[model samples]
Target chain A: MDTLLSGQLLFAALVSGSLYALIALGLNLVYGTLRLLNIAHGDLVMIGAYTAFWLFTLLSIPPVVSFFVAAALCALLGWAVYEGMFRRLLANPGLAKRVEANSLILFYGISVILQNLTALAFTSSSRGYQYLDTVITWQGVSMTGNRLLSLGVAGGICIAALLFLRFHLFGWELRAVIQRREAAQIVGVNLNRVQPIIICAGFAIAGIAGVLVSMTEQITPFMGFPFTIIAFVVIIIGGLGNIGAGVLAGLSLGLIETYGVALTSPGYRSILIYGLFVAVLLIRPEGIFTKAVRS
Target chain B: MKALDIIFGLALAIGGLLVPLSGDAYLMGLVFQLAMWIALAQSWSMLSSTTGYLSLGHAVFYGIGAYVCVLLTGVVPFGVALAAGAAASAVFAGLIGLPVLRVQGPYFVILTYGLAELVRNVVMRIESALGSFGRMIFMVPSFEVLVWCMVALGILATLGAAAVRHSALGAGLAAIRENEVAAETVGVPVARLKLLAFVASATIPGAVGGLALLRTGYFEPAQAFDPVISFTIVTMALVGGTETVRGPVLGALGFTLLSEALWSSLPQLYMIVLGLTLIAFILFVPRGLSGLADRALGRG
Candidate 1:
């Protein structure tokens, strides 16, 4: 238990928490506004990781520079996904009642496609590179500079997103659409314009998180599903569609996982995540921090 | 139409029986897969299609059955082991169905997925702690016998699904799908019906899992509880059309055959093709192959 309270573990938790928060932020945005459960969200992150890896290995460009490019690529993919599949489903007025289930299956298809396509392109092998491997010690706790940089960037982006949602006019429209789609439309919110952008932003954020994750861990075509599950757990903890609360929930879950794994064997990681997830669903189906309407 | 249905059923039964007699291992393997999937997809429809609750954790039931059957192999008769596996899954579903089924829509989907993953991880941990990497069975039944058992389970599942569809229980479950509040108000016994359906849907998969393990002659926790099994189940049910008992049978057969054809040569593109097919089905043929057949027959 002594290790649970150690500064090193605390720093580890913060770093992981930032990554979780960034991952969940995009999922929250997409689900909040579109009502589509993007099971393929993590695959976008994998694409980002691969993007950064290729940029660094082939082009000799740094990951920091590739981050934006990966994000843009993911955003473009998201737009294409919406335009190709979701737009048709959303247009069918008769299918409105079944959209959630329909989209769940559709996104599942997308997830499978993305995973296999990436596997085909990348050979399903794990890939990694040396970037900011230097260890920096502070207050008797040592960590990689890359880890610290990822933490700062992820956290900073989360805060920026929250602020943007609160302050930006477009953010207001997104929140309006999230809070109440029909009401937002009644109030003249341009959903056609807002939906596409939010979906793009969601993918971009997921891509950014993927780049940050690549800094600290190995990347593979199949690495996306676990991250997708993690983001789902975070969003569930924070209350679905509550973008602001996702950050806090993500961080808290990070602490819980880090400390909980420290206390128990690392093999129990999935148990802890799924146990926490199931417990939350059973105990508070409405979520802990906010009563986000179960749309 | 009813006579044609009976003829179709008779022809399928005859084919199932004759396949094993042909003594072709590869063909027997394909038939076994088709039967197993038919049982699984049909069982899944007994709950998810009927009640509008899309569960993504059917693999949990299957894995549990496989684990239990593998453990009980030498200690008990094969039939008893299979029955025990089925009973275990039924009991497990009955225990969790109440609390787990409380959530609806997307929450239910996510919770079921999480629960399956949790169980898979726990099983992995237990296996490792016990110093067992994977279990190998030596005295399992022959392939022909295994295929016969699978065919029986498939037939049983199909009959059960058809019975449920035509019964009052089916009407009540359908009512729940249409509108749960209204179903409850109209005295459909919502909670009890949901649990019953969930347990019923789980039982055959357990038996199927046991038989599947026997067919493979090995059991690994990861392989037994693969989430891909759950995804494939959903895909088959959707692709076959969920509204009729015939749908799952059609879906399982079509998907199994398609996958069999594609997996060997285009292993890399298999999942990609499946994904694209799913998207296409959901977009254009939302009702699935059975629906298309119905329309062709002027019954739609």
Candidate 2:
């Protein structure tokens, strides 16, 4: 444990964790506020990666610049998804039971559609961009420039999101809805408007994660599903709707994954990660949080 | 109702008989695929529809069954291998259900999903475990034979579904689904009933997975433990209608035919179309075909 706790592993773990946090934050945000699972959340990430990839390849735009553009596009997509799919299911208060059963299928279908569309455009080929192609070493530990860039951006996004939720007026409205929906509305929060904003905001956050991914690792049309699964693991471990705990959980999970792969072969990595995920559920299904903090 | 039942049985038997006599490989292949999906849909319906617990990890049992059959090929008779596969799947379900089943709502859904992924990753580590993408041994069975076997298995599964629909156990599951706390308060023995349903639901998928892999002459991890298969199976059951015997069977048949038609014509865009269809179906027609049929019959 002592030897593995060196700068390199810690840096790697922190980077991976921030990326995971970026993904999980969007997931839990949507879940907490909209009461929808958004199975297509990872597809937002995939689309963001593809968008940045295209911008970089065609317009010579760097991923750093394209990240904002992708995030904005994803926010629009989220708005379309809500207006087209989620609004009606939620409009009726009496349909809550039925909604639970159908929303899963709905989001699943959305994911499949997005994945197919992505494949059609990109031909299912894996792509990556070389941004900040430099390596820096500190005390015999080396870090890729691109990875370090992702790490910095990821941490910035997480902190910014945290602050936005903690102090922003819109964030307060979202929290109110998440904690007590009917009461929040009665207290004069226009749910009709606020809900869509949260949903869009969540998508934008996921888009940022996707662009970050393009800088750090490989991107494929099918990559969205695995990341979605990983995001779910992080949120569950961190506690549903609790961003702080989720970020912490992502960091710990990242550490576990890094050290586990180091100890065993790379193939056993997912096994180790999922084993811990399941163990967490068995031990504390609500996660490590004392209270359910949706924001 | 009895007449409909008899006609359905007669049609199935006649269809099964004609396939062997005609010996058309294409027809045989299509029927085999349809039967495999039907069996899987039926297996998934046993719990998901009745208990309202959407298990996103049902493919683990299917993959396990496939692997088990492949391993026991020379060591045991085909009958023993099939039985062993079913038993193994049920046992695995029992063990997992003890913990995950305690969770409710989305947590239950994702935990089961996680379990399937864990199994898939572990399976990926085994040497030669994922046969060349679906190729089973040559000595397994012909397409016609496999089709007939699947038909027989599917029928048995249907009978099981019918029994569960009318049984006291089914009522208990329904109660649990409606309100777990209330059911428990009313002495419904929620955990035991759920475990039983989970085991029962898992067995046929496991057995049929072995049959599927054996017939296909392969067992790739991606194909065997594919999460999409679970989603598709659930969609079929839902589209046909849940909490009924015929809905899943009809759903399987309808989806198989619809999928084939779409794939043959569109090929490239079929998945997107299917996804759209599923979304539309869930949104506009949540009750599915069986529910439509029930309404036409004016049972309500």
lDDT of 1 by residue, B97-148 (tens): 9999999988999899999999999999999999999999989988999999
Model 2 clash pairs are B134-B217, B134-B218, B135-B217, B135-B218, B136-B217, B136-B218
| Candidate 1 segments exceeding 4 Å error | A291-295
Q: Kindly give the stretch of ten consecutive residues in candidate 2 chain A with the minimal lDDT sum.
A: A92-101
lDDT of 1 by residue, A22-63 (tens): 999999999999988989999999999999999989988898
Identify the candidate with maximal DockQ.
Answer: 1
Model 2 error, position A71 (Å): 1.0
lDDT of 2 by residue, A1-295 (tens): 6657788888888888889888998898888787788788889999999988889889999988988899899999989988998897787654455565567678888899999888887788899878887889988779998888888888887888778778999878887887788899999999889889888989998998898888867899888987887888898887877777777777777888888887777878788878877887887888976465433
True contacts kept of 1: 0.95
